[model samples]
Target: MANVLPSFPNAAPTARILHFHDSIEYESRIMYSRPVAKALAHPGHTENLGLGVATARFAESKAPDLHLSPHRDNGDPCVRVSMLSAVLTNKALLNTANSSLKEHYPENFKTRNACPLDMGDLDRLGRWHTRTVFTLGTPDTASIYQREISRLVSLHPYLMHAVLAMTAMHDRFLQSSDLPNFAQSTAIECYHHGCAAALFNAKLSSQIDPLDRNALWATAVLLSSMALFFVESSDPEELWPLAPPSPSHLEWLNMNQGLRVIWDIAEPISPGGLFHDLAQNPQYSYFQSKMTSEPQPGIDGIPYYFTTLYDLTPLSNARNNPYHAAVRTLASLLDVECTPFTMVKFLSFPSLMRPQFKALLKGKDARAMLLLAYWYAKVCESQWWIKTRAILECTAICMYLERYHSGDLRLMQMLEFPKARCRLLRSGTSRA
Candidate 1:
């Protein structure tokens, strides 16, 4: 039998009991969390028929997946929910089930404490297992998403929930127009969103390990992507800079700062870590190397005059002008190809951004807003999570600039790129 470690060794007795109970519930919901051959009887009520024992045996025979149940949802021969009910009635039933589960699932207790997944949650997880994970990055990094992330999910429930939250939100976005039952699905997705973020935030406050560091970093990426998933209306007039400042304004930008903090904590690029090879191409290393307090101009992609608008000069650099870093960093990308690898690198720029740059964007600084509009115009179609908000918000920025800063021909001239770019995006034309 595999040794099931105590989930919370130093936790209070109540916490330990609750953790045990939740572990049992996870087994019950995920089709025999107790994958042992022994029949667990609820003290006295039912005979020990061991109907699920054979299914568990078959599951074990096939080499079960760590986070997922091995057996099919149907043909249980016994309904597992009955075991959950038995545990509720008799507190000792969990010990019986826990011992039974020890043979199969040793390290699953911590990650399975949440309420059991319904059909929708199951569907979302399955989609992630099969599809969404692959899309999060390039195929070269598939091992990180598939192998490393699964290993992390086995160790950290927060990472598991964070992955689920991203998949759920992705699923929600895909089905928003077609699914008539979106409101119901949204409620479930919101539960995932809440648990994933709340637990993740809590975990960030505590001391962590190397593996924990990886898990936290992975969760931060998902959270950042999720931050973009929750924008308000598609209307440009309702968005920030166009409308009055609201709490949601510049959320994606601010969320990136959190990602940077976790990145420092995680040291993903340091030797031996899972994300050490995040820069898939040699050319992309300029992004990691070129970050300087004193940066020069004349870079490509964003117009030369754009940086000049912020009064970026040798004396200013990033020290005096916030736009210098934003402009300089964005300029690095013009030479790199926008493959799946670079796309991930591309989206992460906000994290490396100077706080003041993001602050200026939040304050609706015309220069900052203009620069951001150019960025969105460049990458609006780079990834699915970025596309909707990027396209919509870029258009909003253009309108805001045009509406408020109309007389300035320099600002108007700059608006032309993002305006034409967003027009192409909405028209379904590919920039590449």
Candidate 2:
């Protein structure tokens, strides 16, 4: 048997039916505001989908109104045109930047380079140049590119959408434009040229790869995003979810590999050494003759071009290998018998530091001072691992160095807790 309760005789009046209708209209307008079908029709719809997702994730707080209509509110067509131009131009610039880097530092670009614009050395140079040109309003293409990117990013939603749409429409536009072959070729060339121009201006041409030009541009965008992460106090975990884990083995490999290459070339020939014996032995010459004799080109050839120009070596062979020479180099630096302050400060000198750290650590020395410095600098610059690995590593190093020096108790205490706390008293009548 089922029991049913009767309605109360004295209940509040139901809300007006008009209110429900109004609510439905408001929801309908909001739903209509989103141009999902229109977005689907865009040529770069997939890329736009990614961009939209990223933008939604990144700029959610700032972008309250999601609906974007460039054609509405009497928007300037020129602004839309400019937005499209900027995206295409930027893409071209990125390609050019990579080509320039490949032309300059082919070996490092091929082996050690992470992404096209991931060259720390070149970033510093670009920053310096950006500062100089923007301050002076000079005709620096690097600065111009940077400025345009900034401007485009800051535009209204409609304009930004237009830019994104244009990025998708780029290939189609190229195909449709009835320009002469030379003009069309120039347009195509501009893509690579712009990238090269930017890289050259930043003194990063030597670190480029023709195959990785797009990756380089992506790297630049990533680095720029990383910079913004610091500037805006954004969570890196949210932005770069797949970022390398703490105590990055890959980074350690890169550090050691670079040192190993230096070691192989820099080490003097040992007296009565096997290498020397092999060079002099006539029997070894026969074996050398039996081996395939490919023409080894000098600086003018493909392989030698980047190495001779940049004095950079490949980093692939050093991965997972013992850095014995690197250890020796570090021991030499430490045996100089300088004060801890001097030693720490000396680690700042790149020529003395990288090799020294690699040598001392022997690929197992996780607490190497130079690695600590690198972690510290990256933390300061990008705040990438502030509360995670970087801080932990820095603290551990500080403690290790303190223990090693048998440091002053006061200094050690200061390092532990340097801040003073103040207690505030409440003003109130005393209870009996």
Candidate 3:
């Protein structure tokens, strides 16, 4: 008989982040239950991938109009959600293992220095990222981060572990959720060990070697990617209907700052010639022109954000002009009535913009930052974890702007909603 793994427990009731018309108040208890398929059971703690295919077939039989092709199945939101849940469970188990190791093996205090990452796990992770994660990068450029990570395999285990962990997390979405998974669990263990080892090495060494510097920088980037993947992969339907973005969402944003700090303190990758090539690409000009073709708002309507984005085109000649993309994307997001599927497609905003926009953010361009806050506000309107998370981020942005760009009239006008929202949040009136 196939063994049935426990289903995800009922998540605790969370504070309502959305507004409601509460003309009446009533007390009620709700119970939720889902049927578990015997065929989907994980026997002897092994993944039942056959079940995923079976489940897909079953779903197709019920709703043939979905046109559920095999290729399309890989991208199916439902399947992806199940896969993510399973991976997250595996990630939790890995955490428990590390905690147990620390309590039992005093000598192995740092997991990275003590535990050897399995070669098979590493290869699987690498292959997964090459097939999936790398494809998400800009169309013209060979993924700089991917190339850097691949080259560092022999030179930096810490970096490798981070990259492997991220890839493994992504790979989980490609597997069966109702099963015992090892690859993701092992990847998480490697990440824990690698992060501790790398941070310790970076801190203790007064003069950082180039390799060590690269390791730290790469770790930050990969860690951020991991966090974003977790946030992006989560589905509100299976999870909760109205929950804020997880802490991982904020952590990913913070890692961008960490990357900047790394750049300030130590030299990054030795030969970053590719950055120059990417920056000078002519495609950026085309993107800028396309953005410029869009109708501009009146100056009174905060046109500075769009104008500044236009001006930023010359700053990076070849790379995708993130400012233009962000502005244009925000316009689309505001104008469109987005569902979860459309929302996920727009979630690419952070992924597409982060790599290039880091420089602008480091420089503290007020208009650029304000536009970002606007983008997040648009995100807040979406029905996902990002909604509440984006609200918090918008509030934080308003606070930052108030501290630094208070005198700017356009910034003040742009931040009106964020300020009002922040005030409402602070008043404890928003959380139900």
* Candidate scoring better on lDDT of 1 and 3: 1
* Global lDDT of model 1: 0.56
lDDT leaderboard ranking: 1, 3, 2
Per residue, candidate 3 scores C-alpha lDDT tens digits across 1-432 of 112211212211111100000100000000001112121122322332110001111111221122234465567788766556645544443344334333322232243233433323434443533553343334343266556444544345444445544555444544534211222333243333234333323332333443455545555445544433333222222221123433222334543333334433333322443233544556433322321223233222324555454554333232345466556556556555544335533554554454456456555566666766766665554432244445555666676678777897766876786577545543442211
Local distance difference test values of all predictions, in order: 0.56, 0.28, 0.40
TM-score of each: 0.68, 0.25, 0.39
Report the C-alpha lDDT of model 2 over 82-113, residue by residue, as the tens digit: 66664454444445444443444324323432
Each model's Cα RMSD = 11.8, 26.6, 18.2
- Look at candidate 1 and give me any clashing residue pairs: 27-33
Candidate 1 — worst ten consecutive residues by lDDT sum?
50-59
User: Model 3 residue 23 lDDT?
Assistant: 6
Query: What clash count goes with each model?
Result: 1, 16, 6
Highest-scoring model, lDDT: 1
Better of 1 and 3 by TM-score: 1
Return the TM-score for candidate 2, rounded to 2 decimals. 0.25
Best by TM-score: 1
